[model samples]
Target: MKSALIILALSFIATFSNAQKKVLPVTNVTTGKEIYAKHCMTCHQVDGVGAQNMIPPLIKTDYVLGDKKRLIKIILNGLKGDLDVNGDMYSGEMPSQALLKDDEIAAALTYVRKSFGNSASAVTIKDVRRVRAANKTISK
Candidate 1:
C-alpha cells in the first residue's frame, strides 16, 4: 500500500510537469495576439480578413501557411508591387516589421499560422533568427 501511494504521487508529478510544458505555447499564443492587435490587426483586421483590393487577408493564405523563410522575409524586408493570393491581387506596400524583436515576430507569426482557420506548427524565435540572418546574406 505504501509503494502504491508513492507510485501515484510520482505519476501526478510527472503529469503536472508535462502539463506545464504545454503552457509555454499557450503563453506564446497569448502574447502573439496582443502583438498582432498592436501591430497587425489594423491592416489585417481583428478577424484576420484583410481589406479587399488593398491589404491581403491572413485567412489560410499561402503567404501565411507557406514557406517559413519567405513569410519571415515579408516581415523583415516588406513586400511591394503586384502580388496574387487566392485569385485576388494586392498591389499595396507592406511596410517592414524588422523593428520588432525576433521573439515578437515569431510569436506574432505563430499566432497567425495557428489562427484564422489555420492549423500549423508554431514559429520559434530560433527559426526567425536563422531566417533573418540568411536574408542579410541575400541582400548583400
Candidate 2:
C-alpha cells in the first residue's frame, strides 16, 4: 500500500511539472522587437535612451517605474505633460498609439519593461484592452 501511495505521489509530481512547462505558450520575442524597432525605437532609441531634454528615456525612467496603470495609459493614449524622469524634466508631445492593436501594444510594452536592465511582469493584451476601454469611458 505504501509503495502504491509513493508511486501515485510521483505521478502527480510529474504531471504538475509537465503542466508548469506547458503553461507558457510560445512567445516570439523577435517579432516584438521588430515591432518596437519600427514604431518606438525611432523616438525612444535602440537602447531606450531618448534625446536629452527632448524625448524621454525609457531605460530607468520614472515613467516606467511608477504606476503601471499610468504607464499603460501613456502607451495607449500618448502623453503630453511635464514629467520628471530621473530628476530631469521632460516635457514632450508623444503621439497616441491608439492605432496599434492591443496585442502589439502589450508586446512592445512588455519588451520595453523587460529590456534595458528593467525587470517587471509581462504586459498582457487584456491589460492593454482594459486600460484603453477605461480611457474611452472616462473621456466620454
Candidate 3:
C-alpha cells in the first residue's frame, strides 16, 4: 500500500510539473490580439478602423487579406513609402519592431493575421526566428 501511494504521489508531481512547463502559451490568434493591443491598437483602433486616412483600417483590408508572405515581411521588417489600401494610398513609415523577441513578433503577427476578419495559418516562433536571422544577415 505504501509503495502504491509513493508511485501515485510521484505521478501527480510529474503531471503537475509538466503542466507548469512554459511552452509558448499564446495561440496564433491570441498572440495576434496581444500584438495588436500592444503595438497596432493605438493607430488602428480597437475596432480596426484607422483614423480616417491616417492609419488605414486593418479590418477586411486588402493588405491583410492578400499576400501572407508580404504581410509577414511587413510585420517583421516594417513598411514605408506609399502603399494602396482599399483604393486609398497610405504614405507613411511603419517603424521596424525588430527589437521584439522572435516569438513575440510571431505571436503578434499570428494574432493580426488571424484577427480583424483576416484568417490565415498561425505563425510559429520558428518562422519569426528564421526571418529575423535572415534580416540580421542582410543588415550586417
Candidate 4:
C-alpha cells in the first residue's frame, strides 16, 4: 500500500512537471509616433505643419523647443483663445489630454520636439510627473 501510494504521488508530480506551460502573446509596444498619431495627428497634421490661419505649425517654433514645462502644461491643461506663433496667430482651441499617462505624455512631447524641423531635448517621464503634480497643486 505504501509503495502504491508513493508511485501514485510520483506519477502525479511527473504529470504536472511534463505539462505544457502557457505561451503568452507578446505585448504590443507603443511608440511616440503612434501615441502622437492617436492623439495629436488630427490637429497637427501628418507633416506637423498644422492648418493655415487656424492650427499653428509646430516647426521651428519656440512653443515646441522653448520651455518643456509650458509645453507639457499645454497638453495637460489645454489652450484656448488666441495664440501667437512666429508672428502668426492661431485661434484654435486645444483640448486637455490629462488622461494620458506620464510615459505617454513624455513620449509624445519627445516626438514633437524632435520632429517637424524642430531639434530639441527629449521630455522625460520625470519631467511630466513633476509638472503634473504641480498642476494638481495649483488647481486646488
Most accurate candidate by lDDT:
1
Summarize candidate 3's per-residue lDDT along 1-140 as a digit string, tens digits: 99999999999999888888655345456666777799878888986878776788887776676765566677768889888888888897788777777777777767776776777677777777677677778766
Model 1 gets an lDDT of 0.91
1-140 per-residue lDDT for model 2 (tens digits):
99999999999999999999765432346656877898999999998988999998888776676567788898777888898888889889999888987778778888888888887777777788889899999876
Query: Per lDDT, what order, best first?
Result: 1, 4, 2, 3
Give TM per candidate. 0.79, 0.77, 0.74, 0.78
lDDT of 2 at 75: 74
CA lDDT of every candidate? 0.91, 0.81, 0.75, 0.85
Clash pairs detected, candidate 4:
none
Who wins the TM-score comparison?
Answer: 1
Candidate 4 positional error at 120, Å: 0.6
Q: Mind giving the per-residue lDDT tens digits that candidate 1 earns over 1-140?
A: 99999999999999999999865443388899998999999999998999999999999899899898889999999999999988899999999999998888999999999999998888888889999999889896
